[model samples]
Target chain A: MALLTAVELTIWVLEGQIPPPIPVPGVKLGLASVVTLAAMAVLGRREAGCILLLRVILGCLFAGSFSAIIFSLAGGVLSWAVMASLIGLFPEKLLWVVSVFGAIGHNAGQLLAAVAVTKTPGLFWYGPALLTSAIVTGAFTGLGAMYLVRALRKYRERRGF
Target chain B: MKRKTVFWLALFAVLAALGAGTYLLRGVAGRRAVVSVDGEPMRTVDLTAAAVPYEFTVETDYGRNTVRVSQGRIAVVDADCPNRDCVKQGTISDGAIPIVCLPHHLVIQIED
Candidate 1:
């Protein structure tokens, strides 16, 4: 079930188009991060990491795009690492910050890959640009998780997690 | 008020200041130029000061391409190229980036 959820998240972002702004490069609905955030809050880092790796590998195979895999893997690993670090440092209530930082981390990882692929350090100038995008998208996704958790907790207590 | 919240928030603020600053600076300088394919240098124009929108077409051994530039931006409004990636690149306003038609090898760069 978790596996299915993660796969669906990846597919939605790739095809989904949000209006006007088009997209800021790699940024998206960040649905995967939603799963990441939920795993951290409900499951644990190890379980979250398992989901993360599975999704990255499966998403890569399904998409059949090695380049996309490289981009997403780097971002996913880095974001997961950031989430783990922040969760350790902060109280449970502060998961939103995890989303923001993870988003930035995701961009940094992707930017690093971009720099490697382009063989251009000038691309590093895009780092901050990508980070700002992470924040907006991250905040939105983070808030999404926040509300989702509130609802899930009620359901879980009734049905048991 | 958690320690991690403080830590992450501070870091994102720095990133935002730097990123938005660069993006806004990019907006201010305003750039427009032209690129060519078939190893030919056609012409370069400063789009910021142009009095009106310009229509341009490139003729290559491959085929012909028609582009439109308006408001200091460029897009391949029409092209005979197999893949219309150039037309789909949309209006490129970023100074550092250029609208490129890979099939036709036409480039529109924004310049100082």
Candidate 2:
């Protein structure tokens, strides 16, 4: 669990280092989500939740930002909840579906946090753009996680992790 | 079509519909740019009436942002916020999406 948390933190920081691909506010590739998804698929929901929580807290500390923690926590917790609930309904082969939904939930949670922080109802106007980006980015990360999960499973079977 | 394919199609259709709807609704030309801080109206600019481009800096308890107003458009060209999200948002020619500075608690929205 600690190892996974460290990995997540590294990925989060690394992803942050890259400039945003799109020139829009509040849009990100969310590459760190791949680690969370892989953890959930391989380890378990509880373990994945622990890694996510630890990563968010430690990530904020390392990043040295307080407000970011709020948005990250809101999005991370909501995404985890969606993944945990949907993982059971979908077959393992359909992890991407769970991931897509989870990404949507993450955006929704972050949007809510942004609205609350800014206290602007007008911000909701960006919802459609967010949703569209979520679908595209979510699919990318989901496929990445699916490949990672398969590769890791093979490695575990070979090494008995 | 298979059930799974159908489900995916339906989901995509709904999301696309929403995107199209919001684009049409918010992308229309608006004469006014409404600036607000902490949910309070700060100023309103007549986008259509601005003959020449002008820039103004907004400083509040939260932070500072430099907004530019031109004919029929408004945008935050610079900001002190670490994220620089508002500045990166470029400009809002319409009402589709409000340029937001979360750290500064500022919003610039276009309205008819």
C-alpha lDDT of all candidate models, in order: 0.68, 0.85
Candidate 2 per-residue lDDT, tens place, B1-112, comes to 3688568757866886787577667778898988999888899999988889999999998889999999998889988876675776787787777887878888888889
Per residue, candidate 1 scores C-alpha lDDT tens digits across B1-112 of 6676677678777877888787666654456565556335566666776568888777777568787777766667788754454665666666644454544545555656
Residue B90, model 2: lDDT of 85
lDDT of 2 at B56: 95
DockQ top scorer: 2
Q: What is the C-alpha RMSD of each candidate to the true structure, in Å?
A: 5.5, 2.3
Off by over 4 Å in 1: A1-26, B2-15, B28-89, B96-111
Best by lDDT: 2
Expressed as tens digits, the lDDT of each residue in A5-35 for candidate 1 is 5654665546433432544433465776787
Could you tell me the C-alpha RMSD of candidate 2 in Å?
Answer: 2.3
Q: Give a tens-digit lDDT track for model 2, residues A42-150.
A: 9999999999999999998887777788988999999999999988887776777788888999999989988898899778878888887787788788889999899
- Poorest lDDT segment (10 consecutive residues) of candidate 1 chain B: B96-105
